[model samples]
Target: MTEREPDSPVAEPATALGRMTPVDLSHPLEPGMTVWPGHPRFEHELLQCYTRGDASRHHRIALGEHTGTHLDAPVRFVPGGADIARTPLRALTGRAAVLRGPAGDTEVTPAALAEFEAAYGPVRPGDFALVDCGWAGRWNTSASLEPWPYVSVELAAALLEREVRMFAVDTPSPDPSDSRACPVHRLLLGADALIGENFTHIDRLTG
Candidate 1:
């Protein structure tokens, strides 16, 4: 913006921010946020806001899964776990394959993955495999999150056996039911494989 002449209102300078497309894969965390049973209740409070006459409009949110683009640390499974920040950034950020496999089929059994390997060759190490069970279309509310999709124990081992450095899914979780007891999580996390969940915008990557 150009500066105003004397006796005119001052104008702010134009910013040089470039435009970039955003693919949001995180759930918005709120007080009534939907989470797996027995986890932490998602919450956020706007302590102050610029419009509210505060220094700035900033809110503090607290929840588990942190409900969006997040990582499952190795220590979350192991005793005295490593937490999220300790892992390498390279592990979470990289080239990924948005594989379109079965849908409405939460538990990705071993048989379901056989054709994937046959079609794409072996999934190598250090590759980010974003498995889409077609659950992206159902992310409007918490009910959809529960019944979406998940990876089975066998499939978890299969991905591990295939040497996938990181495996992520679009569903809010990697299990089928609330009381599934996280068998799939244990299988994958216990083996030290990086896991990512609660991802949206998975459909955009299909084409």
Candidate 2:
């Protein structure tokens, strides 16, 4: 994963509040939205609205496949995976616990997992895992998501064995840059664990 140009413009100026508002983590899927080498290009067009004799109304919009803050069902990656429409309501409902970890820490090891679990409480059979890697600050640019952070194979298996439902990270992607195959993805997503990356301002958990 390489850095792409800051092709999209975000909301004008950051909020003045000491508390930060959520800046959108999704890239604007216009003619831009840097994709993998073979992904389809984003499209757009202008469709005119009702026109009067002297003037005409204007409407601009575009259509896309899973555009912006999209949900990718397992079927997206796995063959004959579950479709978004087919997803059960129970699969979407759960209790979210907010946990805080060290700053700049990557690769949440098995030992670290135990430390967190012990501090917060026992790891239930269906708890969600959130790793605050402080990676959200870089979401406005591409460099942030390129080199990501995540759980190791051992920890991944531990989570799976423990029946963890999902895992999310404040970082961009989970897995080292050097590896061609995304093992973290294979280990977690393959097991049907939801992974939410590029999560921003997770420090609010202290609240």
Candidate 3:
């Protein structure tokens, strides 16, 4: 028999098999879901259904790009900046470092971040720095109307210094709900970093 050729090289998996746990970090999109004031509301309309004698069933959905758990692209706050389409996929997916935040409307400060690092570990470069403020539990409740927790500009700067790929929160925004300046949005987007808002089930990440 002729000698067999060497086996073709196989690509390594992105992460060690059986060592990864999947977590649902998003809220379900449905009609009348909690949304930012004055933003487009999520709508799902049936275009065809079995009841209507249609061959197939489908729906028409409409909502603003910022609706539900979503990422804020550089162009959202920065003029002439990169849009979501231009954002690299590597920036969106990565090892995440979940930092616990205080309840209510307290602002996350650099000192708070330092305190977390003192216990768990440092927030490494390129990691998704997700701040779990326990605000997601108030989704669609009267408490949601209250000002949610936010990240301070100083903390934003600290995160940037650490070279984080993404700054995410379990609240409506990194800035306060009543914020007019939106400094955190501007600062993070200005650096081409991503901002994830309205994330849920972040508490599951810690365990």
Candidate 4:
């Protein structure tokens, strides 16, 4: 875990906020961070530095739109679909229902989701349905390679049926790494629902 900056202010714990402490689900952007193969690698170039006689320190960052933690707008796969700027903020933020997947690099199927709902409760409409498969733990490592866990197309349909505002996962993509057709992406984005990928620290939400 990354330590907080010494000068940064401390945030209140969950107990202080009625058991609702905000959890940061984003990964830190940096050079050489793990990204899908064939995608642009993250880069950071020092632009100005006070030690170099410049007024301030700054950097020039270069990365793909899908770098690190990111959201997929309808335009990503849908023709003439709404772009990120047009996507409503309400759709991305809401009461999230975190579904914890079983251990290993397996497909998240409808049966697994139904089992989760049976244990907890049905995923309500307009909720951000985050599926945590623990893949974020492999970030920046060789284990982040292809064949990572992914959501099945059937589960995508189930989420769409539930009318979830967003279907998010910790892996690089909702579809399998070797997928050519990207069935899950098409199924969700085609319906105007957002998909958030590469989210880290999703397990913290349960805590």
Point to the candidate with the largest lDDT. 3
lDDT of 4 by residue, 100-165 (tens): 776676888887678778877888888778889989888888787757888989999988899987
lDDT of each: 0.69, 0.60, 0.87, 0.86
Stretches of candidate 1 above 4 Å error?
1-22, 30-32, 38-40, 178-180
Prediction 4 global C-alpha lDDT: 0.86
Q: Estimate each model's TM-score.
A: 0.73, 0.64, 0.89, 0.86
Residue-wise C-alpha lDDT for candidate 1, range 31-150, written one tens digit per residue: 775566677877788899988899888878777654555778777667776677778776766556566656774566666567656766666776677777776566556656556666
Q: Residue 191: error of model 2 in Å?
A: 2.3
Query: What is the full ranking by TM-score, best candidate first?
Result: 3, 4, 1, 2
lDDT rank, highest first? 3, 4, 1, 2
Please report how far candidate 3 places residue 148 from its true position, in Å: 1.1
Q: What is the lDDT of residue 166 in candidate 4?
A: 90
The TM-score of candidate 1 is 0.73
lDDT of 1 at 91: 70
Tens digits of lDDT, candidate 2, 67-86: 43344465656677666677
- Which 10 consecutive residues of model 3 have the lowest summed lDDT? 9-18
Predict model 3's lDDT versus the native. Answer: 0.87
> What lDDT does candidate 1 reach at residue 142?
62
Candidate 2 residue spans exceeding 4 A from truth: 1-72, 98-105
- Name the TM-score of candidate 2: 0.64
Q: Which 10-residue window of candidate 2 scores lowest in summed lDDT?
A: 9-18
